[model samples]
Target chain A: MSDDIGQKKGLTRRGFLKSAGGVAAVAGMAAGGVAVGARDGLAAAGSMPKKWDQGYDVVVIGTGFAGLAAAIEAKNAGASVVVIDKMPVHGGNSIINGGDFCAPGTRLQKAAGVQDSPDLMYKDMMKAGLYLNNPELARILADNAGGALEWCEDYVGAKFTRLNFHGGHSVKRANQTVNASGSELVNKMLAKAKGLGVEVKTRTKMERMIANKDGRVVGVEVKTGYRYPDEKTGKTAYIKAGKAVILTSGGFSNDITLRQIQDPRLTEKFGSTNQPGATGEALLAACMAGAMDVQMDWIQLGPWTSPDEKGFGHVPLFCERLVGYGPMIDPATGKRFFKETGNRKERADAIILIGHPVIIMGDSYAVPKQVFPRALEKGLENGAIKKFDSLEALAKNYNIPLEAFQKEISRWNSFVEKKKDDDFGCMIFPEARPTVTPPFYAARLWPKVHHTMGGLVIDKNAQVFGFNLKPLKGLYAAGEVTGGIHGAVRLGGVAMADCIVFGRIAGKNAAKETAWG
Target chain B: MTRKHGNIRFSPGWLFAAALAFGVLLVYIGTPYAAPKQVASAKAGDCAACHGQEKVFSPSHPDTKAMSYKDCLGCHAKGGPQMLQGKLPGSHLHQLRGVTCEKCHGKVAKPEAVEEKLCRTCHNAEKLVEKTAKVKPENPHTSPHYGTSLDCTLCHRQHAKSENYCNQCHKFNFVVP
Candidate 1:
């Protein structure tokens, strides 16, 4: 009976002899013809079979901005590309992202009368990243961001309809998409990728990269028809990558265990804004295949999220717009807290130290003029954002001492009148007004795991570097999967730029690789 | 000792036992049926057609052997003593409404999963959005973010308990079915 079961599973004689615990390992060996110890004995790619279950010139593993961008570029470069995603949905976090593409100098910036340059943008990144950023990679992103944004606008046909400001940027450089969601760009990219005959197969997950005896990633072992978060759902198969394999499987923000290993403070107590599939399995698979990782402890937390909401809820849309124009108060103290315009890490850390949710509030003037109407309405509808008729009422709603809160509001109003923040040094926008308006809006602020600043180490050309300190041939990575561009911290809206820029580079370079087969 | 050793050698008796054991193992692991048989002439109360004589409902409920959707609605109104809309899977509702399994799945050896387009054939997404515009918190069919293109299966699973897909990212307590 056991022997029949072994035959049904396509297990070899040796595989059948192994214990049930060794089934998975024996299965890989059966297909690759490399025993467990023999694999480590080889200096490079192990001795595997010549035949493959499937073949593609370039296999891209992800369907987010980075993966789609890579697929489109590789296909355009004349490579027969196939993009695979483990999720049932095509886009990962990119689809749900807030659609802020930061570029140094773009038409949107120009139309908004904002003076910005790539040099200045690079400076802001370096400052926020604590100068730990790889200068070469950061330089590449800064220089090419505008060109990439233009490509997304002109070539991909994704419209950037508005210029917005992110906390760490020097100017209003974030080009907001038409729908204010990354879907506007991701859907367009998906359409373009499909139009170019780039086959995108969802529910197909890469189990591991297959390297030859020379340590070059030649292909990948994948499970087709895989359902995400269900380890037992897919049937294993080997796919031959004729040229290269691109890993753009994004970050580990949603990976609590992995993130806690890197930054112990990031426990499951903190929620993430990423998709459920935004775990570390794919990135760790690359590491198991000899890929190097760097600065993995540097995870970013978004301070704009609300405890009252889920995932990256509409509170972010409300809070981001109100920052620099309103005050974030520690409800416990009923007074102002950290600089509202502080970078993501500082603000999140400060809120954690406070040990309770904070309140970010804006008046009718700021709420109407600054916040997106849809977001404000939705936030209110969800009961995360509340509108109060008076300053006392707002304070009472959040259980803030009315006397202290009123005094703080008066102080904040004085700062607005003087165009200076006397206390926490929040960036005060020129259009700011006092909080004396009849209707006041507020949302309780808390931190949610937002982005990972570390991943696979790659060079400026997007070729992944191996643990052996050599470029892993036939391997490339881009977007959130590859790190060192953001270094210690990734500023807001820079992810879109990073993904688009490096995705194109990885795609073009991957296609240029000599086909091993 | 020699005889005992000889008894352990390959023999037709032992081989027959091994083959029989293997057959039993195959039956244990393999599915008994290829797919659920969908008879076009089957009635709503024909439990034996698909489920055999297994008791699927509580004993306290009226005998459903010959009951249709209208008969069930007599006791289980939209929001009455027993509402089945949110209580049962969408396929059960279809079955009760006289929508045979072959209607949506068609006559096939094995039925495949249906897409949102299949649901839209009967229920228009745009009209759903307009109809539910006044739903207290907000409309579920359309949104400022995804608009009306969200797959119906995300919230209207036929074979399983329906879920509010928006709850993954928002605090919308929508009673989806």
Candidate 2:
């Protein structure tokens, strides 16, 4: 039964005949961790920040989880710390993220008698991230799953009541709360910061790092942020750092310019789910700080698409899926980009099958019932889609090829309705699968720039990697700003886990800094 | 400056002299009396009094709110708080909103009946104004945080210490408002 289960899960038939304890490791990785780049060791990117201002003990850049964690640590260790962020709020994307912690072999999961191990978790993560994630980070995440979970629950007030998500978890280790809101997580992190006497300043945009003669990172040059009315008068403040700098600003999922630079097709077609401030300035900053970069070509996508570019803004994955019905499609072809699957990851693989999408298709049945009507209404509402009683009428309404539409529907029916899709190898098809229904529908959506894979690479200690192949003296980075996490491709939920885990590490390391001068 | 007085004899000579002085003041700055307009005038004073600290949970906040820099610097020299009680009141807290005593406490001492009379003018209670603080509690500080006959400013740093200082050790069960 165990061997059969392994095969069913697509585990390699030949792996370590390790003990049941090792299953925890394998399962944990499988549950919610991705490991890539385990072969040849990573080389150094060779850039460093020198000390500058004398006022601060530790200066953190980017206000996401990484920056916050570092600042909290630095402050508690009897050093004055200043956290600088480009956004109006702290915790960057972490605050806006769904509270589904993908920790494997956690105390919570174990307490529930759920059998899980770090090895399995690692293996699963490697698979989900498609072997593009860093193996070291993936292993650590699996190992510390229990400790991280306990910290999240005890210190940071994460309710973690709900522990389920459809991302990269094999077991139910993704911790969410009752209300299932990101604000709940953000609010808790903020509260925990206060309990530890950490000073938080919002609207304080960090421009760059201040380095001394030796090029040691000293302070961050910040401007009086968004809420500060007189942004023009720009308060030029420099909070000193005695030990290190951590950056956690989010990725460039929404930056039209960055998206265009990375993937123009994605920018022009599929829209972003990130906030308005989803620019990749942090990427630029890290590069200027001497970090090597990669993975600019990769990005994450969701099934939810709209005729009007700004689709459902900032909806959580599952929340939107609840009402989001049907497959997305190309209004021109009335076909689909990939084998239509209910599973989003499989759907992603299908979308990227070709360098470009052949077609985008979906019906009212396949999409969430609530989402279906809403999407159709939005398209028709926005004049992007036309509604008709029949496929011929629909084709004529939108100037689509009537015969082509008929043929496409027949093909969809053959594979979908008649269950003859063995040729196309499409996944399960319910009533919503085929477009053969009386009134068929179609819309156009292309991929867009979803994320930047390049970030400030870090060691197991979460210390910034220098060009010299050693960890930078006192610099650390976490969150989207630090890459080598989701190696070649990033799974949907891995990004959030990276933010929390690495953010905590950056904070703990920065907390132990000494006033050098 | 206008003179504070019960009577002012409006003479043509006096009015002419005032006009001449005002004209000279304006010319010295190379501009007409622009009324110190919003375009150029620096809006200074109490930056924290209006903008309280913004928490991730809370809305926007003031930068220098803990120990009202305006209150302290209103009399002292200039600048935000450097150090008052060895420990600098850490970052700004939005939780400081509920209480009303810190505005005039800490670093400087003030009497209570004097404090009560001062308080009642804005929040006037006919019979309640005359009652003792210990006998009849009014504010958060009135709940034993202000012991017997002690100076109000002894522990409270209006713009320095957070109003939720007592909350340091106490777990507050927030009934979601």
Top model by lDDT, which number? 1
**Residue-wise C-alpha lDDT for candidate 2, range A370-401, written one tens digit per residue:** 34354345455544443456766666655656
Residue ranges of candidate 1 with Cα displaced over 4 Å: A1-51, A324-326, A362-370, A387-420, A428-440, B1-42, B47-55, B58-60, B75-82, B104-139, B142-152
- Fnat: each model in turn: 0.31, 0.00
Per-residue CA lDDT of candidate 1, range A212-324, in tens? Answer: 87777888888887756656467677889999999999999999999999999888879989888899878877776678899899999989999898898889889989988
Q: Residue A236 CA error for candidate 1 (Å)?
A: 1.5
Off by over 4 Å in 2: A1-54, A106-114, A165-172, A226-233, A258-270, A307-328, A342-398, A418-420, A429-444, B1-177
DockQ (CA atoms), all models: 0.28, 0.01
Clashing pairs in 1: A44-A215, A45-A211, A45-A212, A45-A213, A45-A215
What 10-residue stretch in candidate 1 chain A is worst by lDDT? A15-24
What is the DockQ score of candidate 1, to 2 decimals?
0.28
